[model samples]
Target: MSQRPRLHAPTKRLDIQGLRAVAVVLVVAEHVFAQPIGGFVGVDVFFVISGFLITSLLLAEHSRTGRISLTAFYWRRVRRLMPAAVVVIAATLAAVLLLVPQRAPQSLADAGWSLVFLANWRFADQQTDYFAADGPVSPFQHFWSLSVEEQFYLVVPVLLVTTLAIGRRSSPRVVALSTLSVGVVASAVLAPIQSTADPETAYFSTPVRAWELGVGSLLAFGTAIWGRLPAWFGTSLSWTGLVGILVSAVCITGQGAFPFPAAAAPVISAAMVLVGGVRGPTSGAAVLRAGPLVSIGNVSYSLYLWHFPLFIVIGAVDPSAVWWTVPLSIALAYVSYHLIERPCSVAPLAMWHRRERARFREALRPQRRSVQVSAIGLAAVTAVVLSLVATDRVRPIDIPTVPLAADATAAPTVGGEDRPALAALGKGIVDALSATSWPELDDGPGANLVGTQHPECGRLSPAPSAETCTFGSPTAERSLMLVGDSTAVHWIDAYLRLQDDGLLAGWRIVTRTAFGCPFIDASLGGQDATECASFRADTLDRITEVEPDVLVITNTFADTGVDGDGTAPGAAEWAAATQRYVVDVRESVGKVVLVSPPPAGQSVQNCYSVGGSPSACITETSSAWRSRLAALNAVAGDDATVVDSRPLFCTADTCPAFVERTIVKKDFVHLTSAYARKSAPALGELLRSRSVFEDTLVGH
Candidate 1:
């Protein structure tokens, strides 16, 4: 009798099917429930299972026939996976064009990638780009995992065949075992390193993920040795593994180190379950073989293909109806399981597998080299043509954003009578939610005109030579400094415009800004905390030495501990740190203007398209922010000019993406430089009105 259990026999093996069911449920719950389940490791479980099962099948075939048939393997894959996949892709594209025409382009691009089984690469590239990956999401995002699997399938067979050829005298099992061991080690080491450097890219990269599969393959190769363990041992291992998977799914989080340490919980647990099932049915096996789980597993492939699109479309159409998508997805999957999966893959595949020996000689037939060369040449030509025609990357004509009038050389100062009408800003919330299209803004410096401007004075890390970042009248003895984080940098354009309008003819302007470091006395916990700390130290010393006429503080209040003490935000923390900083700086400066961060709600980046209205992205102001602003004012203690900026970006109940003709924000939090420039008149008026700068000053 064969030492290894029959991996392919349905009657004998329902536990594997049950495991698949558990994996799919975990993945679906994470997506549909909006809770922290850490269920993404379910994909890792699938990878391990694939590695083990495919290895078992391949090695078994080689043992029985002395050779593997590439033709049969690839054809069987096509029959099993492609039919359902193609139908879903086509249907999703059609649905996007029909029901949600605004999203059709995203759907179409996703379809092309999915069709070629290269969705992972497409997503990886897009996800790495800050602009492309920010807000717009694809319905076919889940297809990336399928793409990784298909790529694995294409390469693994070739790897096995090549390794077998290299060690002709060695047993096929030995060659597979040795080759997979090295791959597991190499991939395990690379995954965490790459994940730390660029987590999104590492998430999709095949090389980084190969280790998960290698673990399963190693288990499969050793099945002969392990399959003979006692029933009691198998039972104990089975329960332990099931509990491990459940606990990991409940407790592990995706925000930390990831796939390496946390993923081991599920991967090792899955292997244990698989091994424990090799003998008589263990208690773990009995639980996994439950009817509902086995049934879900039977249709799991189709269910996965259907659920994501249904969830996305439903959420878009009516968020209230989104909960129903899962049930509908299962219904559709059941139908698809009956019609497409069984007819195309299951029923005919049994007959094909039975007759594979008869077609061995035909499978070995080689194709002509000329055909291969011609095909490759055509593909290269097509790629070149596509790249050139992708001029959509260039700025589109008729951009939704209004540019400055040609005659307007500088920001026109506006006050009481000249303030533009706020009631008639970007599209209304009602119109916005149902918008079909909007302008696609160019995503270069145009989008980041303010935040990315004046990097010498304002950046992510400490700049030793920032002493040289003085912008206006460098030789003037009287100085002004912009202080705080990237938010403080937002006002650089307004100040520059002030100098242009000859408001500060002789006073020099200096900047002490870093991306995340605010002029507050507290610790921050983010990737750039160290750099921010260094910059904070450098700027603190610089500010006291320069002792400028005005010290402007600007930073987002979203970070909690920034309340002054390194304590949680509450009744005590609200303005403690901020007020303390402002009070201390007052001793060495003329006046301090504490500019509050402008009101920003949800991102409007993906809320509309080229034909859509900006109004569709309208959102409500946060009461918490209003409370924070009030706390800052309460703590000002007569030393600072506390400017509430909500009037510039918000109405009583609504906030807008655009004000007048200028886009108010580039991303969710920061403003466009154009809006800052437009607001120059108001900002200068506010500073002058507050008497922060002496009425008769240098350059006045």
Candidate 2:
């Protein structure tokens, strides 16, 4: 092996390096090899290690000299972390353009946040963002952990400096110990509390996660205890700690989420190993110090940085080769560590004033060009960001051209393969298999035209001007109210066109759609379910007030889970709730129309390219989603109008992304506005036949 990095100098512990190797490998198994080992806990292990190392280094500096030099501390941190991070982020940005064009905007923002050490904040918001449903995971997603550590590096050193200065007469060790103990306990307590409100906050919040690092710092502070311990006892404790880390990785699955009680397992386990190692090699140090393990540890940071992007890009370009990405990621990591990480971080912080007894003043060698180099790096990142802004129109999905004619609406029914729109869509999917580029949209993926009705459609607060949402005719005596999630909103363009074709010349259309808020009264274990439950309650109240002649409801239940768990299949609970909700809507407005979600299709960004089988992309059978639809219909019984949407969008078992010139869906599931509008006649005819227009007919 090429000479291992000598960065750790005298303080280097083989066990710690081994732990890094173990942590990184577990993470790779989860992300690249699809293993269930709580590989994510590897990050928790890293946090503990970082906390231990950084805090020890700072305290040693204070002990050697009367004061700590802030400039020296920050400069070392910049050298160790920033250069490699920037290179990886830049490479990730380039990868986004080549593999997944649509994710470019999100990736750039992710890169920007990563550079500033605020990536945790950006991702926490994204998890709860109702509108950001377009892309796959960001390539720079792993940077959130690096961001938190960077944040730790910034605050902890300053904290030590200030606390030591104020309590000059008091024991510095005691003051440090007390202050950090309080911080650790406070952060540990806050984690579960934050998780109940929002798991993302618990997962990514710096304050909530401080305890993991705090444990490591406390271990460093308690170094005096290690010297007094009997050798055999210390070795036993080390062995137990090694076992604990393994148990943590194997046991802690996503039963809830992270950064709480579950995270404690790895954090404590890491501390145990480090504390045990302070005594001697009697611990599991012999195994940890193995050549292959130490080599992996040496390049661990580079491995962590390279693995995620490789996993994502390989999946996009040639999914068949995804299994082999591990070797590729490790090879790249080795190269990056040698070429970039080692070279940039040649000046180790641990090499503190080898010759001088007068430490702080003598060691303060000011490098004049450091600030200028930082400024230049910042400018380069900013330039790339601005370039992305300039080319904003180079997107994954383009503004659709409405191709379906005005009279093209056809309500889908079983065995309606001959229907003009349905047949065209079937053929489009076939042609798309070998065709490159986006399909020229005929009807939708249309831009929102009736903006007032849909403004902030996914919030608890309904639009104040709900009355202005009326379409077709001014002073129309009858009305149709559209309600539910974005699934319902996607069909608005079609309904508006139904009126334009003079099917309902005097009907006023009202919209009560919320973004991710399905029309269920109870919260499922889905993302933002509690908030969505509130939105559902508010919209239900408005439904009674508006009392449209007929209320149209649509939402995708694939994300939903029953027993208040989004991960579990709702099955009975889902259908039961839909049945009850529809009956309640009927009580308020006397009519309920259920437009079940269409089958999931391959996203337009992939599978719609040349030389790919439509079957390869659109392989998920409708039965998976339709099971929920069937449950909903079973509960509704004869009381509500059940629109079997399969006939409209599918020809047999397959659902195509495109039909003729019409794009069936703008995203993974929602219909294109043009297709919605083009299919208006069919939907109108079905609704009319089901007595939806029984009361609101304009007999002029």
Candidate 3:
């Protein structure tokens, strides 16, 4: 009666479900076991499959009706995805609040973004920021891929429908193929370039990932040609596809540029299987359709949703409990599919096919369905709010107030025993964590110390002249120049305190520092490396011009691994640079004082924020310090004084992150204002005793 071909109901493809199972397994195995580097390619496999299936369905619908219903398409997506997603997010939020309260706010923010399908953009922003790079991983980080998929799906139907409607003279298949090809080619061309430049952002972005989906759409449109291929040829294609997936899973890792040529292995391979097995079974298809594989694939969406948060929670408790999490995730996924996904899928399907008013009245029942969906969504929101309220209070930690002794003024010299005051502070740190209640350290001071007091003086990308700030005895006749990166900036508080104490009476201290740059001439490449090198050259020239009475230089001097060559500087290279710098300084500056790097410790803000004990954050100065000392000591002539800061920050084998109520490093390596200022007396005494300024009067 109608001009449309009689379309058979879409049959369940056991092979596709098996592919889903394989993808989920690969993802779960990669995440849980930290092996089979290509396990992440499973995401690519899923993307391609989604593209093919969605395109095929849309094409089939258009052929039957001559037009596609946008309302039905979007409603189907909502019913199929939203219910399970909402429940899982709500549950994961509750779990995060209870177990990892430190990450509650971040998790809530991620969940909010995910609800609106913008999680990918959020992660992309975070990846671009160097400062936020080192923050702890969020359990919901995997939602980025879902966000990308959702955004792609949202645009594809609209694009295809518009093209089909506007170009009535062109064949629908041709129009769809042309539109999809542009997206595929454009994305393919851009992906490698973006991946090379900023792989972190490229990996999480939607535009860069569009090619994989577009390729799958191409396959769907080309089905007529592929359906006529020989069975033996199909078998070969299937085998090759399976092998490609397996090889990629084994070989690819997170270390290198990704989601381009590497991701192509999985995307193309999955496409081969889809195209090759269109009309008949191949060996790959047979394997995929196995009962065990199909069972897992049947609920792969829910499985993907549940696994990551479970991994994060279980990992926090026992990092090696992947055996438990993997199985638990599978079981929970099965339960979720039965309880939520299966029931939610029915309404969308039932309401999808209504040609007339009577049919719509009989079948749709739209108002009732809307009410039910809204109720479920509201319940999810209420549950999330409850979880947030339950964990609203910050866990309190007892910060021990270690009393400074009457003889706290004693400063330890090189190779001399550590001051008794430092020893007392170490004891207090150990005692503070010994209590039964493991509460978070109140980080009000440490949190505000970095930006509020120091501002952008040592941020990643800094303008040299703008970041340069004056410190001690500004109008004094003698000027002391502090030079290096953040490590140098850390000592500024101490310099200011010494000025107040008149330990630096005649000296006006000028701090010239950048974020991650050392004082050495050799390139230490990072995001800030070029600017740092430029700033370093300018600062050195300034030293020559100012010819300050004291040129005190210091830096972490640690190998920053983000180089253009992809290799960080070793000790030998560092030593060579140090020697070169010292030699240059001797020719220009009147007095060159090299301040040794402070004993490194874990991030005090992170440790305290996570409710970790002070003792847990303690670290020993590594043997690397000895090598650094050897290099600096080699270059030290009578004209240069090398001051070792280990005794000031550590006692023998142990280094505490906190001294009294003063938190040491705000992050991992930079010193906090309070601790830096408190250690000024020792630094002041060192500079006063060993330098040409030794004869200078000690202020009252």
Candidate 4:
């Protein structure tokens, strides 16, 4: 590694190299262990360092010449930052195309955004939800940090020049302080809100992160306050700051949405290190400046750039190869720094410094107009190249659409012959129910049957009771009640097929869309209101009162065994309530059929936005789904036959999101109406085989 020069002049040399080492190590540890650890605050540290150093250099130049050179400053920044960034991005794009699954189009889009420094916005727009266990993990996830830093570098110089123009008579320190104060206050105020709104973006966005950098800038421009401090005090503070940074890395995990309120740890620690290092040689400062630490600092930027792509590619090729691949990745990063990065950076710095010296001695300079024109030309070229690369990265594939074959069956005898009788029965039930009796189902629109007024229900006007929805033809032999939560309602379209084909044997299909309420009389207190509990109780009572021949109850088992917000249930209360409901349903219903809930999967909304067809988004082979079903089925004893849909919906290796070109779901978990209807033949076969419905009468 190249040795860093000791500062002889009173220039603002505040251990930027040491800070870079801190930033890169945090980022690496976060990725390696898959922890949050406020690793992203490393980017905040970088931003601050950039703002401080760049502003100081510009101010120094302006003081010497009485004029600021925007063109020269930008040129130097581009040469320093862009070469490595462009190389890394280009390499990442190639790796993405080669390694990522064809099913994951989002990876391609994310790569494209990274190239253009818009990854923060792209991630924000997509539901980069941290709560989901199996959400999309784009290889280019780290690009958001790079994008924010690059963006800050782009705009800060412009802002500084404008401020200097307006306040020509003001002291440089005063202007710097004013700028830092405004940035700090704005960032602190916006940080919490953005963190709440979308933490992934808040973590990555330059505007929301300006305060961390502003803090550093203020410190850089402010005269040394720590020179008067006792030597022991400075050393203690430095060691404490270093320890804080290390402790945070070891402790924090990446389970929830990140860098929100959690960002204070790394930001504060970084500021401490800056203060400690600036004060004079402390134990911690000496350690940071030591040979091993300085070597890591020299290669840290290249390490950060290379590690993610290496992990991604290795995982893509063989997810199980992490043990060997991780070490190999570190070795490769070290090699890349030595061979590619160190040489490139040194060559440019040497050439630029030599040119600068020659220009200084000659006392000759280009016209302002000529310099501006050259800068514009260079910018235009860079923009064009970046645009072309982005376009190529995100080009869409042409997938041919295949039409599904329809089942060959005519309309049922019930539609023509039993219509009058069914209509009369529906009227009779509606007349029996009071207007205030039925509760409005508060499940989402997709799950609410009464709200949607689905065509199969045959009620053009709203009905007041659960019985009203299920009132059969007077001549009907049996009544089939579709009881339970939204999953049961999803299968209603399938049951409607049986009804359409006269397989229902004049039975009525009743739907009770209680969001996640299991048929058991259990109360999810604080989660569901008293009114909702009552509504569920009343609905269950009505189902038992009507006494349907076959009761189909289904629910999504609580996978986490806790509420959506991750709070644990009161064990004694939950157990008692659950057992009571199970007993009650078993006593009241004649024959209960439990439909195993669909697997917890990625949201189809993100899949669609990323250009995946609906068919590509379904989960068929998730272990989470398998484990959930196993537990739920065990709870359902002999009284109810638990139907495992995994075999019907999924293959051994993969699940067909669309079987026979019919989409299995509208979203992640719920079935689409058309797909639900197509599933009727299989469900009908299951019902007949199990003797839940008589084969001779239903006519499979």
Could you say which candidate leads in lDDT? Answer: 3
Clashes of each: 11, 19, 0, 3
Worst 10 residues of 3 by lDDT: 1-10
RMSD of each: 11.0, 9.3, 8.6, 14.1
What's the lDDT of the predicted structure labeled candidate 1? Answer: 0.67
Global lDDT of each model?
Answer: 0.67, 0.67, 0.69, 0.55
Clashing pairs in 4: 48-213, 520-581, 521-581
Better of 2 and 4 by lDDT: 2
Better of 1 and 3 by lDDT: 3
- Better model by TM-score, 3 or 4? 3
Error of 1 at 260 (Å): 2.9
Q: State the lDDT of candidate 1 residue by residue for 1-700, as single tens digits.
A: 1122111244455788888898888888877885436777778888888888887888788778877888888887898899999999988887677545766766798889988889889889875421122244678988888888888888778877777767778675677678878888999999888776776777788888788888888887777666788878887887788788888888776644456655888999998988888775543468789999988988889999998887776454433345766766776776676556755663333343535433432332332243354345545643543353233223222222232455222112223443332223223322322333343433321223355456566666537375567777657767778888767777787787777774565778888877657777766643455677777777778877878877888887664333333334642364787777776666677778888776655444434334333444566556667677777777786778877665556544356565544566766677677777776666665666557776323232
**Model 2: per-residue lDDT, tens digit, 121-159?**
998886732112343556777888899998887888888
Cα shift from native, residue 392, model 4 (Å): 30
Deviation of model 1 at 404, angstroms: 38
Error of 4 at 607 (Å): 15
Which of candidates 1 and 4 reaches a greater lDDT? Answer: 1
